[model samples]
Target: MLRKALLTGCTGFVGHPLLARLSNCDFSVVACSRVAMPALPASATNVLVSGIDGLTDWQVALAGVEVVIHSAARVHVMNDQSSDPLAEFRKVNVEGTLNLARQAAEAGVRRFIFISSIKVNGEGTPLGSPYRADAQPQPADPYGVSKMEAEQGLRALAAETGMEVVIIRPTLVYGPGVKANFLSMMRWLHKGVPLPFGAIHNQRSLVALDNLVDLIVTCIDHPAAANQTFLVSDGEDLSTTELLRRMATALGKPARLLPVPSWLLEAGASILGKKALSQRLCGSLQVDISKTRELLGWTPPLSVDAALRKTAAHFLEHRTH
Candidate 1:
């Protein structure tokens, strides 16, 4: 019998690709979203929920689902305009997620897979000591805090209900349709703009979209993945300078980077109130995925360079469209 899986956030960057992958596999997917999606796979069923919140009903969607991939949540924004950002995040990311998990457990779902963020661990890490799976959570922002709380709730729910829970915290994910800082870097590199990140030597771990999706799929049926928290990355750490060079190579452009002192750049950013942005560019945040490798025996199929090339190719293909 084909395993039935209920997938939320089917229209999101990760969820969309995941739905496709599940549809192609032995799983019968019910793609749940707030709104309808275009060109959904024929093998998958589409179910629309009003919204994800503490009050939302998921019984119809959880009818025969053996697995639940809950990706829908209030994501992080640059400058949130809400009066109470934490409350807003808690409403959807924490309360809404737990509500769904409870319903899934009641409906006899075996596993609940949560798509979490690296920010749950912390904003940045020291140079040599990367965060491990067992690291204490120190979520900085409201969004990160919400994810951490949601994970806690899921674990408790699993223990109480005997429903397995798999939590995956992925680092900065980049690929086609990427936005924010990663998109900005690609734009600067594509325009042949001279970047001032030549001298900074901060290491950061990143995961490609395909690699993350692959990991999620692996955990769907992997026996050892139950009740496990995994940190996923490309397994190769890259400095800001090295990342730009790789992106330039992928874009087939000359790397026009000016060597600038990290402290000087940080000082300028602080003066301009862009300290957070500067830290992301000049600071280090790495995760050790050794547990994920040893326990699940899984490795990222795509290399960093190859993934960057795919991202560049997508950007170049859609730049004029």
Candidate 2:
């Protein structure tokens, strides 16, 4: 059967890689965007339709859209201030999401796939525990709070309209074209600089770009994905120190991590007004994706090491190019 898909955030990190994978699917895609796209595949009967817009303007394209992939969100960054952070995040992530959900439902779209973050579980990992899909969400930042709210809102809309809602919570995604923290870490490793991350011994789960994209496709095909929130990662957990070491190896750089005492690191963080940063760097953040694996019968295609290598190679190539 020929399925028509409506995709939001078509210009995002996840979307870029996903486009490549979707080229082979039984999908006729129509992309909606708020910002201008750099370029796109020529809209053919195969691609069917593609357009750019704010949520209010989605009706025309949403008319025959069979599925909607909502990946747009205002991500987290330090010291970020918008007049109303929650409102700002909600404007796009929540309200915009709801708008599309309603339209898709009205258009008889079969599924509404929401790309949520693991932050919906919590802000940071506790010393010993990993975040599970079943855990009650205790979001910290405005961004996390908004995503959780959207999850609730989407779920409500789905229930009201009888549209299948598939939620995917991906953790610390890393890959080429990666930005934010992952990019910062790559730059730090490339510098051959020593880091205090050696004192941390907490495992955090992360999903590679390819692995995450793969799971999205899986969810599209898996009946179990309907009306479910699936936690996904590489299924490999690493402490901050271990992560730095592995990233360094990927870049062929020395893992020059200093073994500072945890308490001392905390004290230094306090002095630097970076207690949050200290906690994040030294804390154990992990995600249990067994629900995704067992239910969907899927596994990550690339190991974390391979994913890191590919990301590093992109950075290297970027510099050379």
| TM-score leader | 1
* Tens digits of lDDT, candidate 1, 58-176: 99989999999988889977678989999999999999999999999999999999999998999999998999989999999999999999999999999999999999999999998
Q: Count the backbone clashes (under 3 Å) in each candidate.
A: 0, 0
**Candidate 1 lDDT (Cα, whole model)?**
0.94
Q: List the candidates' TM-scores in order.
A: 0.98, 0.92
Q: After superposition, how far is residue 10 of candidate 2 from its true place, in Å?
A: 1.3
lDDT winner: 1
Residue 48's C-alpha lDDT in candidate 2?
A: 26
The segments of candidate 2 whose C-alpha lies over 4 angstroms from its true place after superposition are 42-55
Cα lDDT of model 2 by residue, 13-54, tens digit? 998677656656867667656655656654412232233223
Tell me the deviation in Å of residue 90 in model 2: 1.7
